[model samples]
Target: MNNFKFSENIESYLVSAKDIFISKIASGIKTRDELFTSLYNTLLLPGYFGFNWDALFDCLRDFHWIDEYLVIIVHEDLPTLSEEELRIYLHLLADACLDWKIDEEHKLEIVFPESVRCKVEHLLSAD
Candidate 1:
């Protein structure tokens, strides 16, 4: 589908959120550290960012400071993370999004290239 992909939770988020901010990362990003750095800078995260998945979840948990109801993170490259790492990353992001949607009425979305899209969808479907 040319339209944005939505699993059950994401669809709910879009239905309720008002404002949206789309953050895009062009190609060539590789490595977990680079992925974190790119996302941190793009999102204008708090200065306390710890550059780990836990820190990422923490930062995303309270992103109202960015002043938007929804955040869509779009990436054009695959990180150097292993398959397991990538799966965990996607789960963490999805969990954070769902948590925010339930508690703060905020939403988060992560979009990658179609190649990664299939992997992401598969990962999410597993849960």
Candidate 2:
């Protein structure tokens, strides 16, 4: 995805996302909580990360500590998130990513299963 530039304003966020996926979080995760913990530990956010959806959003947007963009790689064995749950999680991530653009300092990306990649991408793109 090196040459995959986003819209006029998105910039090169995907490059950092791809690097993070290859180096840090390219594992087989099963649950949303697992994903959250893995990302939290990878990014080394705060010791008191809430490890919940709301907390995740807060930590992602509150990246005053780590100024790098955040890219989440969701490999196989991901938990069976319901449609509603999936939408909520993706929405939060998408929101965090967009908010990062305010300072052009951080961003978020998610690579889901091929089965749901299109669906998830559609959801994020729709935002």
Candidate 3:
């Protein structure tokens, strides 16, 4: 299964999945609080969610409550966070993508718009 990808045509990704859960994170998420709230509401994270980086990573990796075969997180735009926060967030996502790789029955995919493809790649590579 694909991990993280950048594409303008999100529909292409949706068309092939038999069972899919799509969560779109709207634009203008400028702070960690906004990001977490958006994730909690959009992904329907469990009540045990702890509103922190570690908690976000845990929720992203463990989606047992979701029944869909494919889970896709579509980021409309990058959050305007502090450099350190953004780095941590990106790495957490990369690590979660790696963890989800071993799940044969489930897939976690993150898609960013093509406009920010270069920025995302640069941020990820800076790690």
State TM-scores per candidate.
0.74, 0.60, 0.88
lDDT of 1 by residue, 1-127 (tens): 2223433333333233447766665566667787788888888988889999999999877876677777777665556677777777777877776665445656676666656667677876775
List model 3 lDDT by residue over 1-127, tens digit each.
Answer: 1387888876565454568988888889999999999999989999999999999999888889989888888887888898889878888888887887654667788887788878777887885
By lDDT, is 1 or 2 better?
1
Per-prediction backbone clash count: 1, 1, 0
Alpha-carbon deviation at 114 in model 2, angstroms: 5.9
RMSD for each model, in Å, please? 6.0, 6.6, 2.3
Where is the poorest 10-residue window by lDDT in model 3? 9-18
Candidate 2 total steric clashes: 1
Clashing pairs in 2: 30-79
Question: What are the runs in model 2 whose C-alpha is more than 4 Å off?
Answer: 1-23, 67-79, 102-104, 111-115, 122-127
Candidate 3 lDDT (Cα, whole model)? 0.83
